[model samples]
Target chain A: MADRRPRKDAARNRAAVLAAADPLFARCAHPDDVTMADIAAAAGVGKGTLFRAFGDRTGLIRALYEARLEPVRARVEEGPPPLGPGSPPRRRVLALLDAVLCFKLDNRHLAVALEQTGDASPYRTDHYERWHALLKELLEQVPGGADADFTAHALLAATRADLVAHLADGAGLSREDMRSRLAEFAARTLGTED
Target chain B: MADRRPRKDAARNRAAVLAAADPLFARCAHPDDVTMADIAAAAGVGKGTLFRAFGDRTGLIRALYEARLEPVRARVEEGPPPLGPGSPPRRRVLALLDAVLCFKLDNRHLAVALEQTGDASPYRTDHYERWHALLKELLEQVPGGADADFTAHALLAATRADLVAHLADGAGLSREDMRSRLAEFAARTLGTED
Candidate 1:
């Protein structure tokens, strides 16, 4: 298809492209194995469409990551107590971390691919800055939140996709156990542990 | 120049290669610039010797990382107070983390090369395992030590090479500030804060 299109059709094509890329990333043993050509063929779109849609492979992986993250991000942003703004600071911190951990666990392969590609540091991304800011802000609200910035980074570091994958795949740690341990670890940092 | 050299000369040549490669990696804008041939020429040896000793670029990097880490590893295992075996658990934990962070700061370029190459997960390395085990042991001695294992991993994750580079290169955080921040973060996790 040409770059020009009806808005609705453009949106539909973008959705199709993302949807097509998801499982292809999930099933591939390596991220580089899934190319724009593969995504285009799977989505029944031309290679030009995939490029025009996502700019390139990194952009596509990033879009898919952001799309998959939308639901959880929304919940953390506006859902309810615990994850949303309404919860007490400590509880909110834990909830935000749990949400990040869960997201990584649920999308391990995609997360790994997106992280390991583009010769870019995952720390340099906008979403990373956003999450770090949110966590740092929430930590600031806690009583002993003096080192909120560093503490936030430390907490997020624990949930890094590669770490999660190592724990899950190499260490044989169950997801539930991983979550529980992370929650407990965060609690220690927040000074809220029993 | 050949692999069949007497063991003493081989030892001398191996040390010479690591010595020559150190400044090259430290000075280069990119790690790839410090090639095996470069090390060979700098070490006054043949390229065949460099390959015979270290296998390839990734192998050379890994060897350098381990070689550089030997002193700090020794201090943690049996040296004096703080990082040594005799410090209090909380203090020892802080010391170990500081040591790791300082090492990364001191070896930024080489560390990045070792991590970026090989496509290996850093978590699976024997040294990482050793560090985790050591941290877990120290955390186990802290008052609320129930989650020592997870806490050890979380704490170490904060010092990951890429994150260290991000803080140093992009964020432009001063080394002292980074050290202070990490110390404070570890203090929080160790439950030693006021």
Candidate 2:
């Protein structure tokens, strides 16, 4: 009973920390401004608890990002037509990219913070590999005879967090406009444009 | 003659620094490891002169990149068909993307170094604006009626330095293979595949 209690408490604390960190990241003027101390304070936990739950600031940011992305991941994994397993390859491809673009648009700050965390290439992450693999698999099922591997990378690059932020913030592209543009680009790549 | 001598010396020092820095960046294990002191030492100039000439590490790297890119810029500006102004719009788009991919591939470390500097989004650079503007203008002239502005950004994103580095270094994509993939992707985007 005692051992189980600590495990439950750990899980609850993790949830609290992620929930508290999300809005802090979203509202900060710069990602660097949102520190572990700030997140710990907001979560009403000690700084040691924050460090224990997530190893560092980057770790906490990544956890918060993943938590926010969970719903989108679920939709793509097992939801309805156009995003899940039930749709045509071309439609799924467009939907997947649009989902990525929309997600980045919605979580612009967190996404940028995660990508900009360190010297490591963003492409090295398991998250990137998963997306690239899924996209490549879908592109192979499409009719274009494109190089699915490179095509997947090119398609995802179009929705890179920094690029999305640039379009959204610097160029002032509306969410609908960015999504439409990505859909058009993906359709042309798949040779399925109407 | 006395005033001209100092100007001539500065110009000579600038060229020497770039020449010395080129191989250093190419051979470094990591970009941050090659400091301004290393560059000044290689060029036989004082560190103060290096800083005075280029402002900082980012500025020096940018200048060196611009120097190396001169041949490409000149070719695209006025040299010949395909890369130059005389080629058909679709062909020029293909050529322009190819040039960017090849340039990134050839100068992988230096390009990555310049892009990785500090907190700046690479989209804000004047260098990027020039390429995007040129590509957008060319895409507008193409017959497919694609959204030239967004399409230009998407196409250029495919050849981003870190993406090129990831493909070249991490994925082990050969130079020729990378070039071919970019060409194919650009052709499909421009709707000019034969």
Highest DockQ scorer: 2
lDDT (CA) per prediction: 0.86, 0.87
Q: Who wins the lDDT comparison? A: 2
Query: Which one is best on TM-score?
Result: 2
Lowest summed lDDT over 10 consecutive residues: which window, candidate 2 chain A?
A1-10
How would you encode candidate 1's per-residue C-alpha lDDT over B1-194 as one tens digit per residue? 66575699778998999999999988886677677888899999999888888888778888999999999899888899989988888888899999999999998887778766636777878788999999999889888675888889999999988789888888898999999999888887777554
- Poorest 10 consecutive residues by lDDT, candidate 2 chain B: B1-10
Candidate 2 residues lying further than 4 Å off, grouped into runs, are A1-17, A33-49, B1-16, B36-48
What TM-score would candidate 1 get against the native? 0.86
Give one digit per residue, the lDDT tens place, for model 1 in A1-194: 66676588778999999888899988976677887889899999999988887888888899999989989988888898889888889988888999999999999988888777635778888789999999999989988675787788888999998889889988899999999999888887777545
State the displacement of the C-alpha of residue B187, model 2, in Å, after optimal TM-score superposition.
Answer: 1.1
- lDDT, residue A36, model 1: 82
- Models 1 onward score TM values of 0.86, 0.89
